[model samples]
Target: MIEDRPYTGLFVLDAGQGVAGPCCGMLLAATGAEVVKLEPPEGDWSRGLSVRKGPESVLHAAWNRGKQGLVLDLKDPAGRAAAQALAARADVLIESFRPGVAARLGLGPEDTGPDAICLSISGFGQTGPYAERPCTDAVAQAFGGLAALNQGADGIPHKTGPFVTDVMTGFAAFAAVQTALAARAQDRAAGRPPRRRVLDLSLLAGTAMLLASQIGEAALLGHSPGVPNVPAGCYQGSDGLWLMVTLVRDPDFVTLCRVLGLPPLAEDARFANFAARSTHAAELVPMVRDAFAGQPRDHWIAALQAARMMTTPVNSPVDWLADPHVVAVGAAPASVQGALGAVPFPAVPGQPQPRGAAPLLGEHTAEILSRLAPVPG
Candidate 1:
């Protein structure tokens, strides 16, 4: 219902593959930017990632909604020239090539107009010793300390199931591009000389940002610390359903124990406070698990809510879709129609839902290319 179209006349050229850069472009498009997604001849590699309905993958559909697609084989001279031209004319240009590839193709920030905002997303960074190193979401998670924090009960570090690092990097790039655009507009309004903005972002840096607090704690402690709150995790209920319970205040633990009818555990010296409970987590967690297992998930959830304790059923994706609150709030308000047929999507927070499906591979290529000036030899 929110008509948040602020970038009506802005032109965005998205020359990135995978999740991060496309996510940035998608967000820009949600704000009414005219985003042109430029891909290689085989198409954005994401199109073949998984669950492809012909040329459309779920990953591609999710991130690339509300954009026009243009396929160009940049290995060819004409393709490179066309991309450079698009980059030169764009208000914002996003690319995820290796450190120097964009520069070689003449699509770098230096090649663009002075007022352009160019965002370069990579595995490491644009100028580091690891600049050319290849990376993926899993790689970033492993290298950026998230895997360590995500260590399972079996003591094995695990990458998250979703593409978390790439998504976070996309959000970071989106914020950076918006900031640059705002700055450009302010300078223009003040009658100052226009300046080009080049943003260098990376999946590795984004993962670090995601684990900022954990990294800070590790630095301060000189060693890895245990989980801050003991027994504050998912527990299986009597009905064979799982629910997550978390405590922020020390008093909440006491309240939780009382709610679960384990007053003795609350009174135990070893579990007196958060620090004590964390120190004795090995002994305390199993008891808490046993207590939670004595009641159905709904019963515990109700009792905990009544006691002002933080808890909720660990809803699966289907459960989330059918949740009353999620439905009432219209969390996923848009249903995009495509080869997948009416796939529901959550609206971008504080922005309008995208008005179109992911553009087909080169859907508007001929129309868009016809409008461009002929490339000179």
Candidate 2:
């Protein structure tokens, strides 16, 4: 099946660690490329990133799955020779070292030749005032102003769970590479000489791009985006289950009031218009909350949904994983036999079921080195 893939003939050398760089290689492998993950004698630090099972960690296994693993300490002269040799033969080379590290190791554009595409993933990109600063997912979020979008009622912001910035950079890198390669292909076919291009992406830029809408609202409207002037917010039901409700159009308030058995709210002079309802939100919210507190969440969800109001339970991750809609979508398995027992992968549109499990540290070192060995005359 891999042999018949879109990138069957492509070769990718992944020298990056953790989520961003490995994710880029994982994406390439999914499309049928032969991806060789270059690691050191100590292995990728991500091997210890999550709980371990035997020789592999779930996080390491999930992200590094579907690639051949090769261990070479580029800090050593011999290791650098092997790394440069591999880079010289690769179609694509991806790294996440600090700005100048790859060039110092001889794996940069000059070494990869004019046809190879080199993608550099960093926290603040290769050229910036903060280029030398070390950054991780949380650091990028805070610096990129992504945390501002996740503020609570107290106005205190929070970094999101897991590697949001790192993962976004991976998605961005994939798209950028495809665009660059397509343009290169066109250029070469038109008789223009091929030139090696270095693609630079930063977690800062990727995370900022994801916050475009929220930032736009803050910049253009002088306020953060929010549900404007309506009876809308999360409320606790009788069973203590939380659900969100929204009144979008003016008529939605009428529908909501009728559903909650408070039909008079629609015509009450004190709460007649959107402005009145907003002004009296503190007064109105409790009435709605009390009405819901008399019933289980499902009852309100059903009634509000039937009335065409936007309402939904604030489902937990576990609830969403078992949701009927999620099952019907069918992109992910309930669980996979990962290096660390049965681990789950996130549901992504069009992601091929992992064709291979994660490789052990230096697992394919012998296999890869033999392939790169010089030919005998």
Which structure among the candidates has the greatest lDDT? 1
lDDT of 2 by residue, 3-41 (tens): 345677888999999899898888888778899999888
Q: Using Cα atoms with residue i matched to residue i, what is each candidate's TM-score against the true structure?
A: 0.97, 0.88
- Candidate 2 stretches with Cα past 4 Å from truth are 1-4, 153-155, 222-233, 246-250, 264-288, 334-338
Cα-based RMSD of candidate 2:
3.0
CA lDDT of each candidate? 0.90, 0.82
Per-candidate Cα RMSD to the true structure, in Å, reads 1.9, 3.0
- State the lDDT at 148 in candidate 1: 85
Candidate 1 lDDT, 228-260, residue by residue in tens = 988799999899999999999998988988898
Error of 2 at 279 (Å): 7.1
Which candidate comes out best when scored by TM-score? Answer: 1
Worst 10 residues of 2 by lDDT: 330-339
